[model samples]
Target: MATIRCCTCGSPKENGKDKKNRIEMRKKTKGKTPRRISLRASLRASVRDLLHMKSKPAFVNVSFKTDSSRHRFIQEEIAKYGKGNITSRIFTYSELCEATKNFALQNLIGEGGFGRVYKGYIHDLHQVVAVKQLDRNGFQGNREFLVEVLMLSLLHHPNLVNLVGYCAEGQQRLLVYEYMANGSLEDHLLDLPPQKTALDWTIRMKIAEGAARGLEYLHETANPPVIYRDFKASNILLDENFQPKLSDFGLAKLGPTGDQTHVLTRVMGTYGYCAPEYAATGHLTVKSDVYSFGVVLLEIITGRRVLDMTRLSEEQNLIRWAQPLFRDKSRFHLMADPKLEGKYPTKALYQALAVAAMFLPICL
Candidate 1:
């Protein structure tokens, strides 16, 4: 065979045989050599492209000057119903049944005019949540459920109870909410004995403020404005931190539009908390909520039920007893809960009382 030189070493070797062997070796080496890809270089290229690309325009431009304006802007944004936003979810009755152990009585938390609330865990979020399962016999049917879903999907505030999601399967309708560890304000204020001392004056003030913020958000902020028909202590839930959150939307309605003073509707609400004008004339307005808030404020102050027939002869009805006290600053001290042991600041308490008292005339 003819002589040949090695490609690397350049050494003279056998002719045809060595040349053939070297070529084969070269092919094998090329096959074994790994191709290098620089991830850093590719990333740099991607960043450059992103920096050069033109950004898409925003869906909407919003401007606001006052708290009311900010609220209106948020409401308008929510009404847009942008794509990829999850409004609500549908879950099979079997899934919910499994979650609540077939709606067992032991899992029940509380029962309301609308339906029963139960404690449940969602595997997807790995979090504990309260599930309100609407009873088929409830006065509010699918219409109320849909209204609640739409309102909750658009409304979001720290003091307002959040609507995590909803489920509609067959005859079953369910609403999921973040679990309130401390339960409702009514449970601590009215159900629990005075000896419990769980809700002190400070906590009561904080709760009142938080609940007010929630109402203000709904009234001044929500798009088209919303009137919470059922605004009572039982519907205000307390979290582990004692922060109050407004809930229960089965009786809620959209507030009045245009320059009309009030929207006339069928009278619906708890006895003691309903506004006088709403009860008598079936006309509702934002002032109706203010009236209910005043009643809640009274409950926080005097440690009394709105309508307690079992009390002492003169103090049977709390509103009637407190109305006169509200007018005379000299009797303001008597309006506070005696269990407070005179710990609350008189000035702040009086201010809150004044705010609540102003609602009486407006509501009437």
Candidate 2:
């Protein structure tokens, strides 16, 4: 058997020292009993904590410019609704341009419906950051920029990406976030490069739990609750350690409050992730986000895209393709990602699938 070793995640600097640090870490944790945290139980704890949590002032140390009309209205909306307060610095357009080397083509890390994201170094902050430059041609994209800035300014959590600063200077609508080294979950989980290693079953389960904690913070811990209208593989960023943090708040909306049951808004979100009720009637509840999470969980499990035109028409929709297998416990193994090569535990796979089924909008 090979020698046992431990490695630090999300920290490239620590990778070289894994062997040396192993004994120290084990010594530190040797006397303590390790507790296993389950997805369902962690959610229950989030609710209980919310019930007992006392009101507190803004905990984030924020400093920013506030002169433009946008500043007057675009400050993080979660804080406005009294969810929590988070703050960030304001970056000049020139600074961002300089950081990204005039938006070099090589530094581009990601691009999506909202805009192109580039990796940049901010000298003032003394850190690398992911800069999202909103697509100027998109009119609705402009509104998305406003919603994201306001949402991040106030909401802070380990599972939620940190907003370092923003560039709402003139026609430039850019958001600066702490650099996530490993890139989005979609990068590692979806397409497989022949040389790249596939994610192990345990890592997939761990990512699912972390993503849930982030959603739990938004829905249960936030004062008014936040609906993450767009929850998908691309939006869930990862660090060097493979930890998941929910990013891209451009589509976020505050959930219902007081006697209201749900917030009614135009149906919006990724094609396969939108809840049925939301798509049919535009009634969005926390359940909408749940459905999206379920889709992601399934993606993580089966290594399949939520919607794929390349697959056969019958198998194009991931949920529809898996529903039959979900009914019978014996067929659950059939739904596991082929890439896993059967390395995962059978019991844990069943538990993870059960969580996914529970969050999906329909019964298994």
TM-scores for all candidates?
0.73, 0.77
Local distance difference test, each candidate: 0.69, 0.74
Q: Any runs in candidate 1 off by more than 4 Å, and if so which?
A: 1-86, 361-364
The sequence of per-residue lDDT tens digits that candidate 2 reaches over residues 170-220 is: 667889999999998898889789898889887887787788888887876
lDDT of 1: 0.69
Best TM-score among the predictions, by candidate number: 2
For candidate 1, the TM-score is 0.73
